[model samples]
Target: MKMKFEFQFPDIGEGIHEGVITKWLVKEGDMIKEGDSVAEVETDKVTTEIPSPKTGKIIELKASNGDTIHVGDVFVVIDTEGSAEEVSSEDKKDTLAEKKEIVEEENAGVVGEVISSSEVIAPSDEKEGNSASENVAGKALATPVARKLAKDLGVDINKVVGSGPNGRVMKEDIIKASKQPSEAEHKEVLDETVKTTVDAKEEKIIVEEEKIERIPLTRIRKTISQKMTQSRFTIPHTTAMDEIDVTQLYEFRKKYKDSLKEEEINLTFMPFIIKATISVLKKMPEFNATLDEENDELILKKFYHIGIATDTDRGLMVPVIRDADRLSIIELAKKVDEVSNSAKNNQIELKDLKGSSFTITNYGSIGGYYGIPIINYPESAILGVGRIVQKPVVKDDEIVKAWILPLSLSYDHRIIDGASGARFLNMMRELLENPEMLLLKA
Candidate 1:
């Protein structure tokens, strides 16, 4: 006896309630082994491949591409027996009814009804005896307009081949059938219908479309939009901007940048900035805290997990470096590279994206100068690093060239006042200006 199994879409990542079926790896009738990838689902957190739970022949795909599948919804149906031999018509009906019952029971209280595919399974020995029209009582599934057109042209709607979802007869199918030699008397009516159909289609396209191209937001982009909107609306934001003369710090980094590369570590100014910010966060506890609205309290984070805002092809992703305060500058450099590359390549784990006490966005490397970065909500503050440029400055009463680094610190004004925000940034400037001061904290 063949056993039918309905594979439900499992809970993939944390807090993932739903996912869009991006692609189908295996189609109906394809034999798949256990652990074989069946589809790629794009959730808000990540795009991951869903694997088959059992080795079997795919009897039907319950969900279509671009369909939103909720948790506990049946995604695919499989026949564990894996045999292509046809069963009796009576057995087929019983099997389908049984499968429908199982799907309804499993998906009860879920999003949509689990409707079985109308497409018949293949490898049947009989031809006309097992036809879909015969099975469905010789009724050709069609739209109302299609049925009307067939009647107008004196064409037998049931005899006309349907080229639509579940073998539904369409207007085009009727028009094609009417053009046949047997239906020679209906050519005049068919010509008129085709003209009306073409004109209507063209008019619909012109009416619905705009001059500009439209693109749908990806899963990550949509999540970013929602988060940014929430953070902007919920938090009272205030930004403090300043420029630090890091001439000595610039020379210091220039001196050892290549030497560190020998150890296969790509050193950037971000690690130095991260180290300096961590020290300042320690002194200013309010800046490293979250506002618990319900409790009416400030939750100070004892541990530092710095979120590094990185740019990738998908969108902006912040992969956190856990226990940031405990790592040495060299170790910070390595960790920075590791998490950044993982985020850029879309291989970073969901845990790495969470648990950040504070976030640092480096628009500097991308040539952006002084942006009022939004605070990653629940985190009290965010540090924005701008482009480092050289300018003339007074040094011992003499105007000389110095490397000036622009910084922007945006804080949650509800907890951290304007004065505290400025003070927090000034401390970072003091440490970054004097590169050696970072060594004390590192």
Candidate 2:
């Protein structure tokens, strides 16, 4: 009772069309059961493992590592309780022939057949209009430098007779070969190669490639590039910059930094910024809305899902905090730590990265001053926070040092005017400057 089954690659996530095979967990002829993982695949959205549907022995793996497989394509074949004897001799022969054909097809472009001959052939004479460039093995032997010189002189090294030991081509041989051409067309080409008044030997020089390194973009990097390009091109972005005097807020955070640390909760300025931004977004509903281009309308989101832009080794990822308006500052701090760690470790879920009404990027964590961050499209705007530095400010006609935080607000010009954008940043500054007002309003 042997049956053959072809397993198709399923759609692992919504809107996933294709995936690259990252690894193979099972090979052909291996026994497996239902729910066993067969391969790990990376799509534009996420990386996950594809599992088997039936319990059987693996008969064939249709795709190899790094191959791209589309949804509904057969990726593997399984044999249910099938033995080798169950296959007839004709089928076995056919399988062997198919495998041989595949090997030949793959190697035709890159691999050459080795040819050997025992018969001896005499070398061509110089006056016979023939070249004695090839050896008994039918290939020219030349040093890399000689080959480079031949290339620069527009001379085919394979057709030039070398005078060195064992017919090894030298720089002098290449220069001589350039001056004498056996064929009329080749001689014309050499004349054109030496168009300058200088002699061929004096003009010939090998130009080496510039010193640089090239690296292929990873899957996450490609996705980030595509999304950023789309957002920048589709939206007309305008950034407004300002500085906030957060002397009181800085003192407020320092008082609770140690108390929160004892409870295993790390305190940072991000949660306070998040709270202030959320309060401003609620009042200015247009900031938390998306433009419906097809219908010519603005769709405002009722719920507060804030996106925190996190930097990881892979790239920048924005993970959303759902219902952020309902969470306290302490809860927001805990959730921020959890999601950021997950993104850095590559353990974050797909759902956690979507459904954000607005985003905030804190480049200040890494000592960046002010940056014009691109608005994460489909959302109307993004908030950028810069480093807090102590500087002297005139207070009561006297100079005093105060902590100043810089802010950059980028918004879509199609929906928001310059005045509206400035008002948004001013509201955030007011909330951050007064801790009592931020706690009461947020």
Candidate 3:
């Protein structure tokens, strides 16, 4: 006597409609406890594991590896009641039927919002329903966005495998599948079924064959594009570039490098730079403010939360350091190390990745020099630090060897002007050049 229950893919987050089933942790007949990981689904920004809802034995796997599952489709079926249970098969069936009737009656008006084909949608305030492009019995399942993206990319939605829940096609899967080589003389087929009003007169059309391959953007890449575009268009950007010598700053770090290493905190140039930026931001509050374009207001932040831009295999991620103004140089170094390590390993959480008064991108660490970094939107500005190179400088009335750092300060021209940006930057350069100023804030 076993009671079978199906588990559908749950809505992970807003705007996240589907997922690609990367791998299954359990096979059929494997006994699992409630909350045990059953499968890994790669979604936007995070690779999440679907957990078992109840203690049971997996009787059937509805999805295969690399399959896309939709929000409402069943992925696994489990028998909660064991075969040795006291209840008979007939009794279990009768109870299940009663439960089904109750569920159907309650969800009578919301059949389209089904979470599971056989199971009832939960009684929650949150809305549930697949997009219009959801696959029916004979149609290819896909989200409306996926279908539109496919059309834009000149791809056949049917050819793209849905990695979403219950084999539902997602935007990522469509983009990935479109990367595959097609026929040498392949021509993009337009979806003529989509209704559009056009003059009934004959129009000349030419199909240019230039051997072009269209690459679809990943979700992370798509997000980056949208954010970057918004930042470019919404804000009138201005860049302030300067060079500073860090001879004393280098020596200051060199003095305590061995001592900091003993505390398990790797001393990097970032923490020192962050401390200097924080001090400058505190004195110049306008630099750490957001311009409310809609309300015609500028909101100045009192607390200093600095965002560190880190490059990962997925994409560029910025994790914030809260209360950055309160931390010492050594503390900032440890925090920077923790966040950087977590970002590189992809172990950072959503909460840890958000909330920043300002952002700093150290392109210098990767050997880059002089980059006008786009301001992380809503935030007023972003500071870009380039490589520190040894160069000849006029010191004590003589050309001497010094470490020079390239700095690019890109800010919202609407809120921050040339004179203000220069003032803020000059203060930052002053602190960077004279490491003694760092101790004032520390």
Candidate 4:
């Protein structure tokens, strides 16, 4: 006797309501094993693998690749040798990198009507999805990053031949395919389209039709839009800008470059900036706090956890470094590299993106001077670091050359006044300008 096991798309946690189906790892009659990866789902924050809950053969897939599915929607089904059973607590998992946070939503276990063949429009429903390569229909076999890059560049991943191992597609393949059409060729194609449209209009009754491109927003983009709008409208923002001389900080990194290499850690100015921010936050605790609007109180945090903004192909992600006050500059640099890399590769834990008391956005690496960065909501302030450049300066009434770093600080004006905001920026400016000031405990 064959028993049916339904796989529902449970909420992957972190308040995510929906996800985009990126890949289907298994199709009908293809798998036999418990805990095998059945599919990959991409949320706004991360990409997660959907594991098979039982040892069985896949009978039907309920959603198509690239379909947007919601929490509680049935996504797949399997046939096992035992009697049918409801989805238990072990049905869904929220796996983010090595850190696995269990989905704690009440009754997250499978609770859905038996998926009929006519209910779902998945690739497997029509053809039984037996062919491994053809199972996902025309969807390309690429990693989540590669798929995102393809979508962003408007390239057809299915048409771009795979250059990766095991006939898998890669980001570079999509990039090269996108570059295949030159400007002249693109213009020629456009001209032909216009000419064809005009000839058709002349042949038949002319019906005015506007030509426009409509690109659907991804889950990440949607979430970004909502959060940014909420932050801008809800939070009263005030920005303070200033410049800091980083001549010594530059020399400091160069001086410690060799010794730290023995420890296998890269020396970047970010750690110095973080160290200075931590010291400044300690001196002025208000900078490292959250607002409790309902209670009308400032929720002051005892520990210093900093969120570093990382720009990825998917979107902007701020991965937190917990207890940054305890870590040394070298340790912070290593954590920085780990989190930044994990975030860009879509392997960062959701927990790493949470619990940020303060945020620092460093666009300096990309050559931006300064920006009025939005305060990551609930947090009182965000500090922005800009490009470092050598500029003429006045030192004791004498003209001198100094490496200057530009800074922008945006804070919640309701919680922090303009004068207090200036004080915080000045403190940060002083600590960063004089790198040794971080050594002072007070």
Tens digits of per-residue lDDT for model 3, 259-371: 97888889888888998898888788888999987788999999898999998897787888999887888888889989888878878776676678899999999999999
- Candidate 1 per-residue lDDT, tens place, 124-191, comes to 11222222263255666554345556775667988876766445566788879877757455454543
Query: If ranked by TM-score, best first, what sequence of candidates would result?
Result: 1, 3, 4, 2
Residue 281, model 4: Cα distance from true site in angstroms: 1.6
Compared with the true structure, model 3 gives a TM-score of 0.72
Error of 3 at 52 (Å): 1.4
Question: Local error of candidate 3 at 118, Å?
Answer: 20
Query: For model 1, what is the alpha-carbon lDDT of residue 353?
Result: 85
lDDT (C-alpha, whole model) for all candidates: 0.74, 0.74, 0.72, 0.71
lDDT digits (tens) for residues 105-191 of candidate 4: 221110010111111222211212122143145444555455556766677777777765433565668767876876677667453
The parts of candidate 2 lying over 4 Å away from their true place are 1-3, 82-208, 211-214
Q: Report the error of model 1 at residue 414, Å.
A: 1.6
Show the colliding residue pairs in model 1: none
Q: lDDT tens string, model 2, 149-227? A: 6776678877778776445555688777777756676546443243322123333343343322223344666667766
Pull out the clashing pairs in model 4: none
Q: Output the better candidate (2/4) by TM-score.
A: 4
